[model samples]
Target: MVPLKKYPNYSSWAFLAVMAVGALFCSTVIAGVTGQFNLAPVGIFCGLLWVIGGALCFWAVQAEQDLAGTGLRSMSVSILLSFFSGVVIFQEPTLLYFSVPAIACMVIGIWIPASKTKSVWKNWRSLLSGAIFGTYLIPYKFSSLGDMEFLFPFSVGVCVGSVLLVAIMTLKRKKSFGYPKIPTLFAFASGILWMLGTLAIFWAIADDGMFGYAVGYPLLQLNLVVNQMWGVFVFGEYASRHGRIKLTLSTIVILVGAVLLTLSKM
Candidate 1:
């Protein structure tokens, strides 16, 4: 794979294509090995939602180039929606005293970094992406199929949706598809990594697992801390003193909220 410096020049379509291909391959192999090919309608819908949400997230990342900020925005929304799903849809009991303030902290934390970016449209993309991601799992919760069983249909949706999106965008732009080898390899690797993470989350939320959607979902949002570390140490994002301060404060607040959410499960 090419160095990260070459990323800006690579075609997004090619990136999406290779990533989807990689994820599709992993999902197909997993489903085949597990012999769990039950294609519930809700599973298909969940897959479609994942593709669209993932595309939006990629777009937002391209636009902002600030992993921490985009991650915070999207994951914040995901956390909020998952909390709502837990309480309302699943009837999971949450201590309102903890959850209400947790939500407030997350909302405020998400808002703090908004002023860092000039493009409101980019922020909207992140929010919309997160919203879709948050709700996509709801369909999976409704599906009768087991987590591994649903992966095949969901991966198929991802591939199909990605292809359609690429085709539409290519036609609109009147450009031939460009496949840079290094970027394609990196993208493919990313997809594989994503599939692994998805599997972990699926198990976490499965009925047989340790944590249900309410608890497991929010727990995953702790990735925001890792995102921030990459942004600060690797990318040199939030270089300004003021920006650093805001980022620190917001991260602390977000962590507090996440911790509170976990405790609410207790």
Candidate 2:
């Protein structure tokens, strides 16, 4: 496949904005779906949405995309909207006081800059992707599927959708059907990790309902910290003294926010 066009002057701010917007949309869906959880096969629709979101999000992160910025933005949005909806829409009356601080910290943390960038289209794609991913859990949560039952069919849907996307991409690029052994193995490993995370969340909600969301969602945002570490140490993102300080403070704040969000469950 031909390489994408090069941008003579890439704008980090623009890229971050687009990525954050995508994250916001994705988080909105997550909150909305989980708030409306029920026992039906509707998880298939959520799975499809998640597949779309994942495609767009990865598209933004492709080829030198700032993992830290994109991840932080996505998590910030998810943290805020997830709780806001829990309190307002889902009527989690107990969460209001604690959620205020959590939301505040997320707002402050996400605003801190993290990386430079190169593509507007990539950001847009990420935005759409994040929005869809945020919603995939709703149907299964609402469904009467036992923990394992929800895990099986929803996971199947996600896998099938993802495989179809891969097939479509291969066809579009006219790439030969071959996977590098190491990369395929790594991908399988990643798949296992993702499945484990999904199962953990499903189990939480299955056990506790909306209260599960109160705690689990914030825990999920902890990925922001991990992603930032990868960005700073592995990818050399936000390497400058100023950027490092920002990221450090952001991490602290995000942690506090997560704590507050978890406390809301109390």
Model 1 residue runs over 4 Å out of place are 1-6, 116-122
Residues 203-256, model 1: lDDT tens digits: 988877666887778778777778777777777888889988888888888778
TM-score, one value per model: 0.89, 0.76
How far in Å is the alpha carbon of 58 misplaced in model 2? 1.6
lDDT per residue for candidate 2 within 173-241, as digits (tens), equals 776444444434444445555556665667665545545654565567677688778768866778789
- Residue 15 CA displacement from its true place in model 2, Å: 23
Best by TM-score: 1
Ten contiguous residues minimizing lDDT sum, candidate 1: 1-10
The Cα RMSD in angstroms, rounded to one decimal, for candidate 2 relative to the true structure is 9.1
